[model samples]
Target: MEGDCLSCMKYLMFIFNFFIFLGGSFLLGVGVWVLLDPLGFREIVAANPLLFTGVYVVLASGGVLFLLGFLGCCGAIRENRLLLLSFFMLILFIFLAELAAAILAFLFREHLTREYFSRELKRHYQGHNSSDVFTSTWNAVMTTFDCCGVNGPEDFEDSLFRLLSPRTMVPEACCQSNGFPGDVSVEQCVSGSATFRRNKGCYSATVDYFETLLFSAGALLIVVLTIEIFAMVFAMCLFRGIQ
Candidate 1:
């Protein structure tokens, strides 16, 4: 038992290192792929404009944090003197980059916001080109780039792609049976006239804002946790590489 326990402890030490690197890898992948919000289509832009923009910013920052944390963790597991030293320097640069971006976002957010609002209003009135309901889903796209301190980046493109992504919806039968607001409506004696508001694959301000808020919060969590996971994974990989 004593020998087994000792062996287990030794194994745990290595396992933990592997876990560290695993976490780092996972976070890195998620940071790159699982991102949404400013890049997603929740119709938050035309719906609540500024409110939705804030949510998108928060969600994006969360992903950035995960990426940072994972990088740091990967450096932690490095025993190679050169690798360790390089990571030390890299982490500092990453931190500075983040700080600079934060400052820029803070300063530019207000100036750009007024124009941003106007554009959103326009989109709202126009209703997102007949294809999208609540028509202004694209306004938040600009808002996101402004907040991110970039004019035209892949981030902007990704945001648009997310909008065109397929959406999940309840079946017409289910919606009608449960009296959900869907395409089909029934006219019953007690209910009189039931109308399912015509939604052209777009949500109104209330729906968009609420949905974006929830998704934004979810994205934040995923990013933050993913970073920690990356850190753990990176640590493990580093240790194993040396062994």
Candidate 2:
């Protein structure tokens, strides 16, 4: 009965590791895709330092998971104690790292407020249709969120774009309309007319979008951590049963 249980656990470990390998491959592929940026998605993420760091984090995680999965599979199949031990250590390290990251994120949460974002926006935003990455990214954000600047049209008052284009109060992206350039005329939008202007700032909409993504990611993190625990347990059990 013990032998049978050990055999079953070995197979379970193999299957679970195989799935983890596949997941790692998928993440690696996504990281590569973003890095290569054939679809222009990289431009959006590259605009933010945090988002850019997240890409590398994904790549690192995928590589670690790939290595772990390989070690687990080999250790289970060959009944190699060294490989199993390595896998266990790696998982534990990752678990601890995740806990630390979570703690740090919680502690720094206060720094990520709207005022902070608005200050950053004020420092960097050039204008609508500017060729710079920061301007382009902000344009994309304003357009996607249907919000203007970091805190409405006034935020652009002192912008380089406004300085250059004295007549235009806000970008065309700030127009409230059914289409890309907006159904309203540029003159109307620039005139600060309520019917044509997007009065709200991008902060609220940006927060909502990121909060949803973070919630989903947090849930996924929990699931991954749980799986790591099970994997460590199985690896340890199998290592002991090997003799």
Candidate 3:
């Protein structure tokens, strides 16, 4: 009975190490392809402008933490304090980062509104069965935000308008080509252009925030994932040494 129990324990440990390493690897691949890829960024932002831009940071960060937790769990099972502690430390750090961000958002009352972004999604459609796409688009937006940083709903609305607004398409000369008629002060031209530019500015801010948030998420994922991989390797070494 004692011999059988020991063998069972050994196998369980091996399984833990093996499975976590696999999970870690899977997470790393996702972090790279889905969250960090530049092309992926454009698709996500264009589809669900509001949802993806805000919380994308957390998705990628937590994913890395999940990988770390797996490593630690496996390391503990193998009785490797060094490897186990390394993962634990990573979790502790991630927890703190999440906590700080959450507190700040709450304290500042920085709520993200999805209305504007969803509107952009609606516009993307060919007008054939576009309603059903909202939730999916919204979820994608949320996922993007999770992996990146989003300012709020307003920010995305502004960004979309900036990049896609057609105000620039309408040249000022078209409005003024008739000449101010009476006295066309220089202020008129400046003010007229500025008025049109305001609309573009809104979109520019929105798009800029979204892009920045996505890039930041990608950056963090790269670093955290690297650590997660190292933890897995360490766990495997311990598992092998156990034999």
RMSD of each: 13.5, 3.6, 14.4
For candidate 3, lDDT tens digit of each residue in 2-41? 5555445445545544544555465555445555655435
Model 3 regions more than 4 Å off: 1-64, 67-74, 77-197
What is the C-alpha lDDT profile of model 1 across 107-180, one tens digit per residue? 86664444454443333332123344443344343232222102211122223322442231211211123445
Tell me the whole-model lDDT of each prediction, alpha carbons only.
0.39, 0.77, 0.45
10 Cα displacement, candidate 1 (Å):
16
- lDDT for position 43 in model 3: 45
Tell me the tens digit of each residue's lDDT in model 2 across 13-103. 8887877676677668768987996544565566667767878988888788888888788889998888888888888898798778778
Best candidate per lDDT, number? Answer: 2
Cα lDDT of model 2 overall? 0.77
Best by TM-score: 2
Ranking of predictions according to TM-score = 2, 1, 3
Candidate 2 collision pairs: none
